[model samples]
Every structure is written in structure tokens, then in C-alpha cells.
Target: MILFGRVRMLLLRTIAYLIDSFILFILVIAGFQSFLLITGLHPFIGRHLYSISGNELHIWLFASIIIPVYMYFVTMFNTRAQATLGMRAARLQINTTGRIGIGGAMLRALIMLVPWELTHIALSYPKPFWVAHHLQSPLLYIALSLTGIYWLLPLLNLHGKSIHDFITGTIIIRWHMPPTKKP
Candidate 1:
């Protein structure tokens, strides 16, 4: 029974994450297009944007993904809902043992960004760098390991709390809405 419940929760969480990711992707694309148009570079946008490399690519990734993701998580986590759209859809809520102020939420968001930023760093390097390093990408290895640890910690905890939760003193739990009184 416990195992089944765990699996169900896992599936819900995965679906929620996918939905959130899709939303973010759409927002990023729209923002990118809008930027190009506003800057009068629409004509040079589409295919050329795909060929961006080096510092330009880094800037784009940081601006479009990192900052937006950080802000999204921080805002969602700190709100009355205490969950992102994904978590809410999955019937999950963030609960802190003690009061977690804006600083706590921001720290949690920053810690959550570690694996993502590390993976980006590993992948953003030039192809030649990987080849020269004999394909032994330390950053990639570390990022993957950390990602696994972050995810696996939830399974180890009875409350479904992850590493980020431990660090920030927050936990994710099933949300139950209060019943309304009949008028």
C-alpha cells in the first residue's frame, strides 16, 4: 500500500514538472521573440539565434532560463499557495517547520539551481574542450551525481522531503483544502 502510494505521488510529481517545464519553455520563446522584435532584429532572429555560441549562448541561458527559473520558484514558494503551479497541480504544498522568510525561499531556490547550473556549465563548453579533456567531464559527472542525490533523498525520507528541504527546513506534503461551510 505504501509503495503504491509512493509510485502514484511520483507520477503526479513528474507530470506536474513536465507541465511546468512546458510552460516555461513557451514563456522563454515568447520573450525571446519579443526581444528580437523590440530590438528591430526580427529579420536576423530565427536561424541566426540557433547558431549562437560562446558568451552569447551563456548570456542567453542565464537570462532566459536561470533567472526566470529562480524567480519563478522563489515567487511561487513564498506565496500563500506555497507551491509552484506544478506542485499545486500535483496536490502538493511546501511546509516549513518554522517560519521561512524570503531569505529562506531564495536560499532554497539557489540551492535547487545548483545541478541545473552545473549541467549547463558542463554542456556549454566548446566541443573541442570535451574532446581535449578525453570526454571526462567532471562538471557533468558532479551535476548528475548531485541531481541523483537531491531526488533520492525524498525517497529516503518518510515525509517526502528532499535535500533542498533539509537545507531550508521545508517539506513538501499533500495539500488538503478546507471544506466550505454551507450557507
Candidate 2:
């Protein structure tokens, strides 16, 4: 049956998502730092950032974003990753009626990157030229902002769907795994 009250489901789904996103953040950085270094750049924390490669940075950043999307999609679409490492840890999963799509997954990741959304103002894309000298290009911050709009799904969607999920036709459902029947 299609769901009517999406709040509970949305909360569960979001919690699961946070778990996966957190894990993906750690794993992707640990896995890809060396690759970023291969491009003759390294990630460092400081007041003044280093590197001039916007394209390289974009690529690395995209990798970081895409991993979680893929992981989330797998769980949302196939309902497997839902119970995987992150979701299991958080006790969350996909909805029975909701599902994930490739486009939706990508859209969700893209949107989540947006910053300063609570101000209810459009974010201006900063055109920092120095990034190009380091082997990078202008980033699609707007795209991320557009994608970040997904956060409003639970709030905006009476049925509990973010723009990405709405576009993908996926809904967050409170997941409860029934006991398996032994054959």
C-alpha cells in the first residue's frame, strides 16, 4: 500500500542516510587522498588553502559526493544497502513503497553539497580563478545548491519526499524487517 504519513518514514530514512553518508565520507577520503596526491596535490587543513587545480579538486570532490549517492541508491533501490554497515548501525533502511533510481541518487548527492541553505537566499557561485592554475575548473556550486534542495523533502513533502526523491519517485519508509522463513 502506498504510504500517507511520510514523517516517520522520512525520519528513519534520513537517519539511515546520515549513517551511510558519514561512513562514505570517511572511506572515500581515506581511499582517495592518495589519488588526489597523484595529481600533485594533497588535502591539508589551514587558514590559507593550497592547490590551484579546480578541475582536480572538482574531480576529487565529485568522487567524495558520488560514493554516498551510490551507496544510498543501492540501499534505496535494492533495499540491501539499507541494512548494510551504516544503516544497520543506525537502525534505518528503505521504505517498502519507496525506491531509488540512478538519476535520483545522483541528484540527491549533488543537492546535499549545498551550503548556507537556511538563509533562504540563493548562493552565488564563487569564480576563483586561482583554482584553474592548479588543474581544476569552476565548480558547480549552484548545482550542489540545487541538489541541496533535497533537504526540504521531509519538510515540504506532505508525503515525505525531497526534490531528488520526488524526482526519482522514491519515498522514505520506516523499515522493519520481518523474520525470515527458513526453507
Top candidate (TM-score)? 1
> Please, what are the lDDT tens digits per residue for candidate 1 over residues 6-75?
5666666667777777777777667766787789875436655446554555566677679988898888
Could you tell me the TM-score of candidate 1?
0.79
Which regions of candidate 2 are displaced past 4 Å?
A: 1-8, 34-51, 63-76, 79-85, 88-91, 95-148, 180-183
Per-candidate Cα lDDT values, in order, are 0.74, 0.49
- Per-residue lDDT tens digits for candidate 2, residues 58-122, read 44444554455455545454544434455565565444344444554555544443442311112
How much RMSD separates candidate 1 from the native structure? 3.7
lDDT for 56 in candidate 1 is 58
TM-score of 2: 0.53
